[model samples]
Target: MLASVGEIVVVRDGSGPEILLVHGGAGPRTTWGALAPLADRWTLAYVHRRGYPPSPPPQQRQDFEVDARDLAPLLAGRPHVVAHSYGVLGTLIAAAAAPGSVRSLTLIEPPLNYLVPDDPEVARLERIGDAALTHGMDMDPAELREFLRVAGAPIGDGPLPAGVVAGVRRAHGGRPTSEARPQLEAIRDVGVPVLVASGDHSAALERICDSLADALGGKRSVHPGAGHFVAAAPGFAEQLETFLHKSVR
Candidate 1:
């Protein structure tokens, strides 16, 4: 079935314990390809966050709080929540606001900068990200390709797909949300299971995942040879299934 929460679009499929899959800037369709295999075992709610296509554009510039508010009602019955990249920010906020609204959390390569703000590697990434946010679409072709590579496209030496470039451009305009540190304590207090996973490729992301795991008292997993797109990796579904079945707190 399909539903709309404010301007957000949610598509549901399968039948079992509810699992809300929130995609990052790439939109809900990005998760459809990688996570379709789980539909047999999970009643999945895939959210297309505001500003993404099919979801109406924001009335004004919206941040993570806007997303969290939109997601709260969907969390009814305490569904197991999984989010990737920027989607993780809103998921964390929603889980914190409604303390027991989430049965468990599986975050993959969430760019939670506040977790390790002082780390040098994170600082370097921050600089790169800041630059991209400021000049991504304006960047030269070569520069944009490098940016895409650093951002984890998992593509070969060929030209990037047009859709990928367009997605990045659309995402570059997003406003920054408030720091996530304040919500960490509340999320931890909720006492639900949390699993933080990241790819082994980026040093900064690894550190961020480590710190996020420590904050939530959650287990951590690293997908070999994977980058930001860890969900598309070969064993990702297996790992998620294992965690969901055996790691409930």
Candidate 2:
């Protein structure tokens, strides 16, 4: 039987502590479902960001300001948490918001404002960044998702899944100008046992993860075969298990 989203504190029953799993843009809990095999050794809870997946929500520029504190009420307390990409943005915001609740965190590739590379030696890079940033603060949801996907990074020829691309339309526009600076500040202030990693291939990913690890007193792991998706790398589960085992005490 599956555990109820609200039944577990922090999220679900992991081997060491609780793990709250948050997904990136246009993704669903199924995004993490692939990792369910890890559930045998660890309790995992996958969050759908409320209105995402099959739910309906307002189209507005929202902030990760609420973090897991929004999930806290449901989880009862903060447990060890893990977030990826943009999901890490809010997870970090939450940890900073309610330090008492979280035990430890493993954040892989949280996108900070600076990760958006500005120097694109190639014209395509420049164009990608320009289109992605689009005034640096628009309320257009599609543009926002598109920017994140292509900004500072190569636009892979791979076609984005229709469901994934369509998911952006569900969100309210891009980052709010007033909120961006402060949000960045909050992530900078998070002082806790944390792990930050990125793929070796991503310039911005490597740079930002390094900066975050340095600032937050975190361990940096550069997955050799991975890029932005470090958590999906081979042996990531074992690495995480080792980290969690040591961290639980």
Candidate 3:
């Protein structure tokens, strides 16, 4: 059966403890591949954020708060949340706005820029992100390439993938409504079990992940050889499974 949270597509699979899997700019399919393995332990609810196909086009401007609002109702049961990239921003917001709405939070390289604003590496990333948001869908190819690189796309010498470019365009317009510091404070106060994970690559992302972990008083893990896409890294699923077991017990 098809279900939606305010026009955002929600796909569910398996039968077990509920786990909400929120995808980033890459959309729901980014989490689809993990369903089969996780389904044994988790009933997964994969969210297709607004602007992604099959979901409604973005409503007005695309603030992270908008995404958080869409997610609030879905967290009625305090499901465990595993979010990546931009999705992580929304998940944090929702968790903060509705205390106890999130049983546990597993963040995969969340781009919470405000977490480490003073870091030189983070400042460089802010410049790239600002450029992408400014250009929106009209971003030039060169700028897109750089943005993808800074955002941790594994794009090598080849041209940027059309799908990835499209996803970036879809997500580039909005600014975050709330800053990370306050959200972190709220989540910390709520006493949610938070786990911040990032790939060993991407210096900027690693730093942001570390700072966020510190702020939330959460555990931190760095996946070797994984760039921004830590979810797909080797042994990621196992590590996550272990964390889930330990966190809930």
Candidate 4:
């Protein structure tokens, strides 16, 4: 059934302990299809993301917090949350806006770059983003996509659900963008039990996740052979569930 809060496409179902899945960047709900099997055993809420297809029309509040706010009410009494990329940013903001709404958080390559300025890679990222904008996305979306993959944005050749791919094209606007500065600042103050992780292949992800761990005082993990989207990697769900249940202590 559709969730009462956020975009109309927001949905929650399943039984047992609850887990909210939020996709990073413009990827919509189905981006979690590989991980959806977990929902069968655990109550699941796969947020459709504001402004995306299957969601209500977009409002003016494109800022990260507004996106985060839309998902807040869904947490009515939910406990655990799992978010990736931009979704991680929103989840963190949501939990802060209403700390009572969430119990624990698992962030997969959150792009919270508070101290990432010094890295030469960050410089290259800005360059790549600019080039992507100039090159026109579809000209070769794969090039830019791979950049994000290295930066923890997850890139794959598998075609996404049609509506989901369309939603990403609309919401992401074809760029390997940086985190919104204000939102980055807000994350530094989030007080919660968060497990921040990055793939061993993602250097930029490692940098930001390390910064996040330092600021939030959270534990960290690294998935081998995975880029930004660990959920897309084989065996990721098992690792996440194990971490969520045991080491999150």
Q: What's the TM-score of each model vs. the native?
A: 0.89, 0.71, 0.90, 0.76
Candidate 1 to truth, TM: 0.89
lDDT of 1: 0.77
The per-residue C-alpha lDDT of model 3 at residue 89 equals 82
> After superposing candidate 3, which stretches have Cα over 4 Å from the reference?
137-143, 176-182
119 Cα displacement, candidate 3 (Å): 1.6
RMSD of 1: 2.3
Winning model by TM-score = 3
For all candidates in order, the CA lDDT equals 0.77, 0.55, 0.77, 0.64
State the TM-score for model 2.
0.71
Q: Model 1: how far is 124 from its true place, Å?
A: 1.6
In model 3, the Cα lDDT at residue 244 comes to 81
Query: After aligning candidate 2 to the native by TM-score, how far in Å is the CA of 46 from where it should be?
Result: 0.7
Q: What tens digits encode model 2's per-residue C-alpha lDDT throughout 1-249?
A: 234353222235346445777775535343454466777766676666645633334244434554344555533555667787656766766666566566677887665645444534223333433443234334344554455553222344575456544454444354432232223344445555677766676565566677777767777776655445566667676677677777653
How accurate locally is residue 231 in candidate 3, as Cα lDDT from 0 to 100? Answer: 80
Candidate 2: which stretches are off by over 4 Å?
A: 1-16, 54-59, 66-69, 115-161, 176-191
Q: Compose the digit string of candidate 3's lDDT tens values, residues 75-145.
A: 99878889998788888888888857778899988877778867887876766676676676576777667
